[model samples]
Target: MTPIRIRIGRGGRGRLSARILVSQLAILALTGVIGFALFAFAQRSALDRTYEERAVAIAKTTAADPQIRRAMQDGGGAVVQAVAERIRQSSGASYVVVIDLHGVRHSHPMPQLVGSPVAEPIVARDGQPHVGTDQGATGRSANGRVPLYGPTGELVGEVSVGIPERDVLGELWHELLTFAVYAAIATALGAAAAFLLARRLKRTTFGLELEEIAGLLQDREAMLHGIREGVLAFAPDGRISVVNDEARRLIGLGTALGSTLDEVLPDGRLRRALDGTLTGTDISVLTDEHCLVVNRMPVTLHGRALGAVVTVRDRTELVGLLRELDSVRGLTDALRAQQHEFTNRMHTLAGLLDIGAYDDAYDLAVESAGAGQALTEFVRGRIGNPLMVGLVVAKTTVAAERGVWVELADDSALGADPPQLRLLLTIVGNLLDNAIDAAGDGPPPADGRTVRLALTEDERGTTVRVADTGPGIPPGARESIFEDGWSTRPDRGTARRGLGLALVHRLVSRHGGTITVSEGPGAVFTVRLPAPAVRPKNRFAEALPVGGDRR
Candidate 1:
């Protein structure tokens, strides 16, 4: 498998808080300015419309007065001026003028300007009325004009009332100031909201800049995949959160990073452990040919359970190495025992020779040679495979050390493939060890405290029978004997005492093998390992890909 590489990014990066604060404040202020401007424009339009409409109403009402129309028909005089001035003053109009249909003003704000033609001819056009801004005798004003007619329906005069542009602007400016105050208050409130928002964002980001956050994400990806051990984490609701490449291969999962834990593990025990419903340390589990030791821990923050993280350690190869080590250790001890025994006899022969007993020394030497030859023949005649032979020899000496006798009654030539050889060693080694323990102390201490092994292999595969003469298994206790953490009897201060039988069961079931026991004068266990074709797996296998993609 290819290794993941790490990457470095720029250090001492700036914080994003200041930038965000400035941005938000600017946006809110801009919105306020635009909003106020639109308000002012629309208000000005409405106010001007109101001003024009008011002037038109006043001018039309004054023109419709019977006294004003009668005076206009009598030609310009003081009565006309008096009525026009009174109407203009009371109506808050800038100027109220009476004009003849010929466009000559009959009465005006300035009497001097009376009897003069109006400035805009549209206002004086025959039988026409107009509302607009125009330069009057005094100044530019929004003017509204209305024509008066005699009872005969003939146009005789026109009334013009003006609202000065200066007055209209003054009123608009005052209203705009009030509106601006309200807009300012609203803008201030928005700015306050933006300030709080920026602070919350800064806290959530933990003062990291955008680039720094991106860099951290990249580093997380590299770190998760770079480790050799498997790591898998789940969310509070059981959905898979993080899964590394090694985890996928160890769990035999296929592209399961986002799936729920149950979907990938398919083991209820494992799920319970992940969700904190079950908890244990260094729990052993079997998956295919691999033996995994899982350690699970809850992910918590301030006493709240977030989820769990499970670390998987592959112990398959380690176990095989341990078995090989046991074989080696056993052979070493056997050789040491033989060396000690032979040395004692040689010394006895030497002393006898020193004492001039040639006959006795000769016999002793012959006996020693015979004993060594018998030991060699015994190993070669029963077990042909060197590794298994070493194991049996070691077990024999070990059992002897504990005052129990161990024997390999029969063993066929185990010329099997490497896969079958590993299976053979694991199953037989565990059973033999268990048998020796069950046999307890040897002969005379107990009537028949002996452990025996029988093995035979054919096209259908190998069968093994182990019988021990110690206290045999009790009735109805075989059912759960192979269950994990279920020991026949508890060892002092030890909880996982009977993992051997459990492991044996796993290997047997994995390889389509059958194992059964019977209670008698002694306990006898018979196991039948299926042919190599039934289950073949090389002990030395390479790592799989990120997912379970065989391709």
Candidate 2:
């Protein structure tokens, strides 16, 4: 990465980064100010101590001087005053006062004040030395007062030495200049570090402003969940990077972020599609609930592979509706063919009548019309629901087209929620289609090629049993026969070849119904679906056809 420049001000490129830099610099400045104050305070104290030490040394040396001691014993004020003046001038002390044992000043800077009491308070009044800061003849100073004694060690007089407050402050200021220099260096270093940090942030942010980042976040969230399709993203290491709500619902996974794709998708095929080998094109993925057509795209930036994203379009409901349409279309074609055959028969019958063959025409008309009439009459009489009756009639035509014979074994009525009836249509319609395909092509109404559906209703529920003269489900596949994408016949090239049974199983389980399969000579599947709770106005239960066996 190349070095990036950043200006830290109100008009900077990144307001957020600039603000952070300003904050850091402010903190550093405050810290330096505090440190400088403390250093100055300590320097003042140290300078004061140096001044005090100088004062004490001068006082003690003056008191121990033989010449000054003898002069004090001899009461030679001139000699003592000369010695005090010499020490004060040489050591740059504020003042040097020599007081006799009677608390009278012997030597003072002012010659007229000799033989007078010391201007300052006596600190060695108990015949010992004392050191402290106080106001004296010369304004406030660090003073050291020493007791003077003769050769016999008898206290005679005292010598007081002091250094002025101005001298201490002057030295403190000199040391403070050094501290100020150090503080400036420290503040400069801190500002440099802050500037570098801000520059790094600018590069990482792609030089976008704070407002731009917020807008990007909002747009990403809207695109993730606003669309109907499921979206899943995976990092390069195979962990799930992002999963939208639709994806969770479609795959029935919760809180799948940061998990492996395999953990979210138990189906092996679906997991493999999310692998990094994705070539940025769409593929189909079959989960337990959805037949999702997935489009995978490799997520890259600047030609670097980051991960992959997958978009899932749910096709389960659309596929079911298409299957239903195929059944209805087959029924229409069958009805059209039947209509043509009847029309031809009518033309033949009309010719017969014209030729005076009256017996042949009458027989032909009854037989042709009666065939369709009997089938509808039988279906309507057995099933009290007009909707179920129509479905059965259509299913019969479709079964015939496939060369399989379909018949109802028992007359049953339905009393269920309207939504429940729609689900039952799916169940019955899919089962009939599968049975037709399984029975294969054969002459209708023949042995080893028939499909029988029995509908029975009682107080508890409706039971539908479908038995077909086809090969039975094997023992090994009985458990997984209802699972998605589990098809026995792979030759049928359909996108949702085995999804019909899976849909049946899903609807049945949702309604707390059960479906079982048994092997007789062929396959027999029985489904028991319960009726919805009855109300006072309920009218469909226990219904018998008025045209046949109604009371």
Candidate 3:
């Protein structure tokens, strides 16, 4: 797999990037607005000052001139026109008008105002600088108020000049436009840099996260594949996420991901087992044909549950071997019985021959020989597996003598794959022996204390139920029944050993079956086995070999 690379500036990271960028842009815009206002104010103030100074200079020059005084006194109304004309000829003057002290316009920028009474009077009758009164039509129409004074500083006719408002606003507007253009360029550049930086940071973080996840997945896969036990993991939604190879083979699934347990096993013990396990119930199931032990626990992080992981181990072959061992133990008991019987016969024959009753001794010897032949035939009829048949037959006789009934419920109907069948019988034998031991040496319990065996198979597959009527297993001990060294029988001793049920569990898994023991009128053990949907031509051999190493 190619490793993910951490590239910078591939995609944007967080909202803060845009937010901060916009905030800075807004600040820039606001600053630009404030600066524009200040610049406009300064330009307007300077223009007003220049216009006022020019007007003042022209008025003083005209007033101080003897020619302008002579002209106004002698030339009469023509004096104002001649002064206006000379002022208009001066620099930076657009329009000029002059009025006489008598409140009559003399020279108007518009020729029509030349003969009119000023229409706006500037000087009062006393002519004391008009004593702070507004004089109408004495000043220019466009610019603001202009107060006039004669050469002697007393109020005279007012003179005003009009300055175009556009000059000041035009300069301010030009400066504002330049600022706006610069701000826009700066904003664009800043935004682009922010986006690029955010994208780079985002990509780097995402790449790191992906690398970590990939490593975790690889580790999980190794753990699943390398472990001997089958492992299954699922999400809270009941979707199977991970199934080890061992688990796949055990549950007969080609693939587990994206599939639920219901989809994998359909409606079977494996599915049931998983359901129970996920719900925090640990279960052990055993029957005439199979034994399975399942444990489920929720995977959690910081006290929160992520999902559940189930560990399934098949104990079919293990159970079968344990039962086979029990059968051998039974045979030893039979041999011991036979030795005791033979010793008694030898004593009797010796006693009779010593008493000189030779004919009677001959008849006694024939009777002993006949009894041995019948015992051999009874054992041969009951034992199943060829390798261990002799041992089991002997054991059956021992169980019967102890008041425990050993019954076969048509094991051939189990329909387990041929190799699995062999393993099944062995597991059943152990369960039967355990039940027999629990029954003890007394009249059976009022409930008959009998061990019941039932095996049936059909299109849905095989089910074996071996329930015992002996005092039902203790509730607390039921789940632990298959655990190694969990025997309730103290009398069986180490000679019988506690490996029986543990081995039973091992064999159950070898054949991909489930074992569950429940409380009933007595103890009921149910085993369900689903035939491998894709049965290999050498299914049994492929799964496990006879007398092979078993763990």
lDDT of each: 0.71, 0.73, 0.58
User: Which of candidates 1 and 2 reaches a greater lDDT?
Assistant: 2
lDDT of 1 by residue, 490-536 (tens): 54232234556766776788778999988645778888988865444
Query: What TM-scores do the predictions have?
Result: 0.62, 0.65, 0.42
Winning model by TM-score: 2
Residue 5 in model 3: shift from native, Å? 32
Tell how far residue 104 is off in model 2, in angstroms. Answer: 5.3
Full-model lDDT, candidate 1: 0.71
**Colliding pairs, model 2:** none
Q: Give the candidates in order of lDDT, highest first.
A: 2, 1, 3
Q: Which ten residues in a row have the lowest lDDT in candidate 3?
A: 542-551
lDDT at position 501, candidate 1: 70
lDDT score at residue 70, model 2, on the 0-100 scale: 87
- Residues 435-533, model 3: lDDT tens digits: 666665335776554555565666755676766656667767766666544566552321324556665666677667888877644677777767666
